[model samples]
Target: MTTDGVEAVFLETHNWGKAAKFFQALGFDLEFSTDHNSGQLRNGDGPYVFIAEIPEDREPGVQIVLKVTDADAFRPDPAVEVVTPFEDTHFGTREMTVRDPDGRLWSLQAPAKK
Candidate 1:
């Protein structure tokens, strides 16, 4: 299926404080901070950024979130490997995970069904 476009960037960091500060320096304003050492940031009308803390032993990485206007209508191509089906998120959206041919994971986000 066709996706709207890139919606946000998900980042994993060992040091939440430093990572937040780094993105803030790049002109991203913190939209909201969760008690769980993570937060969402935005620069303007563009896609936002989400940073979450991971264990020190884990390597930091970034993943892109693709926007889907209608999760129920999404029918990905047969070649796409859907690692996880769309599920409601604590943060309010419905999200799905997919692995690329190269084995990289990506996230697809759509508004929760009413």
Candidate 2:
């Protein structure tokens, strides 16, 4: 039930290309780019940043990723609603999503299950 710290932050951008370039100009190195509508940037240390392009109708915001010991075992608080249940990601992690009371999205992720 305890969180260590933020592992990443996902930012919804209207243009992934522009956003990536912007972050890169600010000293964030491109870790990788994916065809899945998103890319990752990092300062070569902890807390990587991710940018994802979404529909114009959707609001752009930041999603905080929390490192958890067991993403599957972690449940959302009564005040929050589960968006995506814990599932294995193609990038090799177990992740779950929830919408906080303020409507901000949060993700809980754990190392890939062995």
Candidate 3:
């Protein structure tokens, strides 16, 4: 299947408030927050920003969540690195991860099965 578009931006931040403020300054409105820490923000036309508290074992970074027509159908060249095979995630979506030439990780997601 073909990729639809960008779905969201998964961000790891040390301070949620600071990150939210930074994105807000860039014009993303607060979408929703679980407690005062994690939340989704949007710039009206969608392609949301999902800000999460960085875990001890995880480094602070940003991951692009791409909307794909089918997560299982996304395949790159054989030389590309696959961080994860497509699988059902806890957040209710089928997702997979692949690393680019520069070592940037990208996640391709499809709607969860019923």
Candidate 4:
């Protein structure tokens, strides 16, 4: 599968409201929101920002979501350990999660099948 580039970056935050506001102040437009736990802000072309609340036990950092042409066909490099294999998500996309050598989380996703 070929990668299209980053689709979004999920930023774990203690306060989604403040985070969204901060990004908006910096010129991002609020595209969508959820009262449950997350919201999205976008610059319109690329680099959509998603902020979600997390428990204290979880680390607050960025999780990159890369867009792929076919997530099911993409395989992790043998040298790089994978945390999860491709699975269908409730949001309707197929996705997988992996950790790089530096331990940063990377999520690979494909557009939902129509």
Candidate 5:
């Protein structure tokens, strides 16, 4: 299936506060913050950025979230590796994970069906 393009960037950081402040300094406005030390930020009309705090021992990384209008209708190409099927996310969306040829993980996100 085809994606509508990146919807957001998911970032893992060791320090949530510092990460948030850094993005704010880049002119991105905080859209909302979760009690669990994660938040969404936006700049202009581009894709929003979602940053979450990970344990200090964990390596921080970034993943691009591709937008799918309908998850149920998504069909990966034969060469694509589907790591996880679409599942409801706590933040209110349906998400699926896939592994690229290089072993990098990418997320596909679709609006929660009403």
Candidate 6:
């Protein structure tokens, strides 16, 4: 399936509060902040930048989120690899994470089914 566009950029930081402040200072308007210390910010645009605390098992890195019209019907080229199957996210979205041949990670997200 074709992607709609770049949906967001997720950055893993050790300190969410400090990260949020830094981004806000750069003019990223706060969309919403969660109790979990994560939030979505944007500059009156479609794409957003999300800052989240890095999980214990992983190193801090940037993940690109691709917007898809239908996560359930996302069919990639047969030759393309599938790293993680699409699944529901705690934040109310359907997402799938995949790795490119060069080992870059990509996440695809769509609104969850009503």
TM per candidate = 0.90, 0.74, 0.78, 0.81, 0.91, 0.85
Displacement of residue 38 (Cα, Å) in model 2 is: 2.0
Inter-residue clash pairs, candidate 6: none
RMSD in Å for candidate 4, one decimal?
2.2
**Cα-lDDT of candidate 1:** 0.94
lDDT of 5 by residue, 1-114 (tens): 688998999899999999999999999999999999999999999999999999989999998999999998999888989999999998799999999999998999999988
What tens-digit string does per-residue lDDT give for candidate 1 at 7-40? 9999999988999999999999999989989999
Residue-level lDDT of model 3, residues 1-114, one tens digit each, is 456889988888888999999999999999898984899999989799999987668789888888877655676668878898889998789998889899888888888876
Q: Please, what is the whole-model Cα lDDT of each candidate in the order they appear?
A: 0.94, 0.85, 0.85, 0.82, 0.94, 0.87
Residue range with the least summed lDDT across 10 consecutive positions in model 4:
71-80
In model 6, the Cα lDDT at residue 75 comes to 93
Models sorted by TM-score, best on top: 5, 1, 6, 4, 3, 2
After superposition, the stretches of candidate 6 with alpha carbons farther than 4 Å from their true spots are: 55-58
lDDT of 4 by residue, 1-114 (tens): 456899889899987888888999999999889977789899879978888988878879887898888765676668767788778899788887878789887888887666
The reply for model 3, stretches above 4 Å from the true place, is 55-59, 72-81
Expressed as tens digits, the lDDT of each residue in 1-114 for candidate 6 is: 777999999899888998999988988999999888899899777689999987668889887899988987889877667788789999899998777899887898998988
Per-residue error at 75 for model 6, in Å?
Answer: 1.4
- Looking at candidate 2, the ten consecutive residues that score lowest on lDDT are 71-80
How well does model 4 score by local distance difference test? 0.82
> After aligning candidate 5 to the native by TM-score, how far in Å is the CA of 6 from where it should be?
0.6
